[model samples]
Target: MRKEFLPFARPSIGEEEIAELIDTLKSGWITTGPKVERFTAEFAAYVGGRFAVPVSSATGGLHVALLALGIGPGDEVITTPMTFVATLNTIVHCGAVPVLVDIDRATLNIRAEEIEKKITPRTKAILPVHYVGQPADLDPILEIASRRGVAVLEDAAHAVGSEYRGKRIGCFPTTSVFSFHPNKNMTTGEGGMVVTSDEAVFEKASLLKFHGMDRESWKRFAKAGSPRYDVALPGFKYNMMDIQAALGLHQLRRLEGFLVERERLARRYDEALAGVAGLILPSRVPYPVRHAWHLYTPLVDIDRLTIGRDRFMAELKARNIGTGLHYTAAHEFSYYADRFGWRPEDFPEAHFVSERIVSLPLFPGLTDGDQDDAIEAIRDVLKAFRA
Candidate 1:
């Protein structure tokens, strides 16, 4: 057994990130200011987006995107139940109904075919998440949305560098949100960005991001300017701070390299876990695009396993190896079940995958020896606990 504990994920912060953050602090402007603006512009270029708005988190981005799209009460947004609750919560925050479609068992993404079935006159948008950083089959989804005249608001929190076909994840005419959480493919010390090609949504989301403060504030509060400003609309205080953007600036610069390391580690996990009994590795997504490999999640085959997912996780921990549950079916949560009258059987694929999925330790900072130890621990646990 290894003599130390390993976390499921860890941020790969470097000297450059620390130096940039210090520079932001020393510049005497720590809130939303020039650094934040620069980060947004640079990120826009990185993803080939026409506009990018930095926010406090992906949840805030989603909330702003839905609001900017004019999704409100009586509107319905189609999404997946395999995603984090934030996706559903943001739809609810917009006062719109979140209509969930079951995931494709192969991809763990919202099934594009099932989407058209759920559309109604009230369906105003299709919110699909790139589950586990694998690009959802988006051409069909986009075509459906176009034909239906409904917007596509992608929850791309797990995918910053991911692409669909030849286009980047956030480069479409529709809006998409990317997370910069500490555990994400790259860290901004907690932040997110909204990318869009639609100028109208971009303008509205910016105005709604910071208490609806007009862009004139930057001019008004200048060295020689007036202090007058106007609030165009009621908005949330969800703007990203300079400190977060300072981290983001460097993170984005290093993201491509980080992704390279992430992919290498993910592939190593695939090879290491191959033919391991009672475990099913993540798929290599048959889609024609690059996977950011944000997570290396494998399903624990309970039918062939001796222990339940929870027990398996506990055993991994006792051996000083950590693991994570990417998600439990969102609809099966008590709040959603009670509020929407949802049941486990309502989405059989989501329910089954939720119970078996576990995110093993895979990060840029993870050494080959660390990963080897993790593999051994998993094998040991399976051998010792096998039915």
Candidate 2:
């Protein structure tokens, strides 16, 4: 057993990030200043987005994006049940109902064909999550939304560097929101970005993110600016800070290197874990795309073992190998269950994967020795727990 405990994820922070943050602090203008502006512009260019609005979190970004598109009370948003509850919570906060479509068990993404069947007159948008950094089939989903006169919002929280069909994610005609949390591919401490090509949506989202103020803080307080500002509408305080963007500026520059390292570790896991007893590895779709490999989640085959998923995780923990549960089925939560009267069988694929899924460690800084230790630990646990 290893003497050190290995975490499921860790940010790859470097000296450049630290230096930029120190510079921002010494500049005496920390809250949403020049750093934030530069990061937003660079990020927009990187993602090929016409506009990018920085926010406090991905959850906040989703809320603002939904409101920007005029989604609200009595409206329905179609999404997958296999994602984090924030996806459903944001819709509920907007007084919109979340209509869940079961995920494809292999890809863990919402099925495009099944989406149309759930669309009603009240359906305003389709929010497809790029599950585990693999982009959901977008072409068909976009066609359905266009034909139905509804919108599409991408939950790209786990897909910072992912690509689908020869194009990067945010470059598409629709909108996408990406997370910059510590565990994500890159870190801005805790921040997110809403990327969109729609000029109208961008304008509305910008207004909604920073307390509905007509002028941003940096502009209002600048030498050639007026201090007076006006609030056009009620909005939340969800703007990303300059301090956060300080780190983001450097992190963005190093993202390509981070992606290469993550892919290397993920492929190592695949080679070691393939056909391993009491475990089912993640599957790839039959299309041309680049998976960001944010999390290398596998199903613990509980039926073949004396231990259940939780117990299996406990066994790994005992060996000092940490794990993570990316999500439980959204419908299985008490709030959604009580509100929608949903049962596990309502979304069978999501339910099955929810019960069995476990995220093993996969991070940019994970060394080969660390990964080998984790792999050996998993095999040991499976061998001991085999029924």
Candidate 3:
């Protein structure tokens, strides 16, 4: 065992980000201002989106996006049970019912064919997450939503640089939300962005991202500013701060490089762990796509091992290597079960993926030596139960 513990993920922050943050703080405009504006513009350009609105976090962005889409009580949002709970929480907060669908066992994303079976008159939107940074099969999902006149909202919290069919995830007309939390591929400390091509959705989301101010309320405090403002609608407090944007601006500039390094590291993991007995590696689809590779997850075949997934994690921890469970099936949680009457087998694929998935170390800053160490540690842990 190594003397130090290796974590599953860590933000790659450099002096540039620190320097930019210090400059923003010393400029006496720490709240949302010039830095936020520059960051938003740069982000829009990076992802090829028409407009981008920064917010407090992905959860806040989803809530505001649904509200902007006019999704409320008596509405249903089709989504997968394999995503983070925030996906379902946002729907409930918007007063909409979450229609659960099974995942494609390979990609662990909501299956496109399964979506049509769930659409109803109350269905207002189809929300799909790019699970673990692999873009969902959007062509079919888009076709169904378009035909049914149902809006499509992308929960791209795990996929910032992912591409679908040669187009960036946010480049199209759909409303997409991204997360900048510390554990994600990029970090703004705690922030997110909402991108859209629809002028009406862009206008509404930008206005409502803050306190429903006519324009960005941060502008009201500048030298050339208006003293009064009008509230056109009731909105949440979700605007990103200049402090957060300070980090995001530098992060955006380094994002492509970060993604390149991440790809290299993920490939190394694939090469090192390919066909290890009783371990299922992350799947690669035949369709053309660019994966951001936020987390390289693989499932453990517990039946072949001596212990359950929890004990496997503990064993790794003993060797100073940390692991992460990306998620648990949302429907299996007590609140969801009691409310929706969901059984463990309602979505069999989700339940299977949820119980076995384990996120290993995959980040831009991890070196080849570090990866070798992780592979060795995993091999040692699995040797005891190799069938």
Candidate 4:
């Protein structure tokens, strides 16, 4: 048994990130400034996006995107219930109703075929989450959105480096949001970015992200600038700070390498757990898209296993191995159930997957020995449960 506990996820911070953060703090202009602008530009270029607006969180980015698109009261946004609560919460925050669709059991993403049936006059957009770094089937969703005149806003919180078909997740025709949370493929220490190819949406998001300031305060307060600015409309204070952007600048530079290491570890987990009974591993689509491998989640077969998901997780913890629950059915949550009148049967696949899913430890810095320890722990737990 391992002597120390392994966390389900850990951020890989290096000397460059530390030095850049220190430089930003020492520079005295730590709010949304040069570092933030540079990071946004570099991130935009990295993902082939026309514009990228850094925000406080993915939830904030989603809210700003909805605001930019004018999604409000009486508007309904179609999304999947298999995603994090923030995916649904942001729609409600934008004063729009969150209508859920079931997920494809194999990929754990929203069922693209069911989207058109959910479209109504009140339906304003399709919010597909690239669950666990795997890109959702987007071609059909885009086609449906185009024909129906509804927007497609991707909740790409788990898909920073993921690609759909040949293009990156954030490089699509419509708007998308990418998170930089500590557990994500890259870290900006609690930040996100909104990417868009639409000029009107870009302009609206830019204004909405910073207190609706017509001119950014950073530019106005700079050496060769005017001291005044105007507010076009009421907006939220969701801009990313320079302190966070300083870390993001270096993290983006190292992102590809980080992704490579994560993929390696994920493949190792797949190999080690390949024939493990009572476990269903994640699957990928047939297209030639790169998966970011944010979480190496596998579903436990409760009918075959003696212990349920909760007890299995506890056994792993007792053996110094960590695990995570990526999500439960968002629609089944108390608030959504009461407010949206959602029942468990509304999204059967999401509910089924949610009950059994467990995120194994998979990060850039995880080692083969660490993985061996995790596998051994799981094996021992299963043996004990079966005994």
* Top candidate, metric TM-score: 2
Model 1: lowest-lDDT 10 consecutive positions: 213-222
Question: CA RMSD for every model?
Answer: 1.1, 0.7, 1.0, 1.0
RMSD of 1: 1.1
Cα lDDT tens digits, model 3, 1-387, are 677899989999999999999999899889888889999999989899997889999999999998888899989999999999999999999889999989988899889998999999999999999999999999999999999999999999999999998989899779999999998989999999999888888888878887888866667866788868888988779999999999998898888998899899889888888878768888976678999998998998887888777878888888888888999989999989999999989999999988899999888888787788889988888888675
Clashes of 1: 0
* TM-score, prediction 3: 0.98
lDDT of 4 at 361: 93
Model 1 off-target regions past 4 Å? Answer: 216-219
What TM-score, computed on C-alpha atoms, does each candidate reach?
0.98, 0.99, 0.98, 0.98
- Over 1-387, each residue of candidate 1 has an lDDT whose tens digit, in order, gives 899999999998889989988898898778888888899999999899988889999999999999999899979999999999999999998888999999988789888988999999999999999998999989899999999999999999999899888788988878999999998988788899999878889989998998998864555777987897789999898899999988988889999998999899998888888999888888766778889988888998778877899999999999999999989989999989998999998999999999999999988889999999999999898777767
lDDT of 3 at 223: 72
* Candidate lDDT (C-alpha), each: 0.90, 0.94, 0.90, 0.91
- Which candidate achieves the best lDDT against the true structure? 2
**Cα lDDT of model 2 by residue, 150-256, tens digit:** 99999999999899997888999888999999999898999999999899999899999998998997898899989999998888999999999999999999999
Over the full model, what C-alpha lDDT does candidate 2 score relative to the true structure? 0.94
lDDT of 3: 0.90
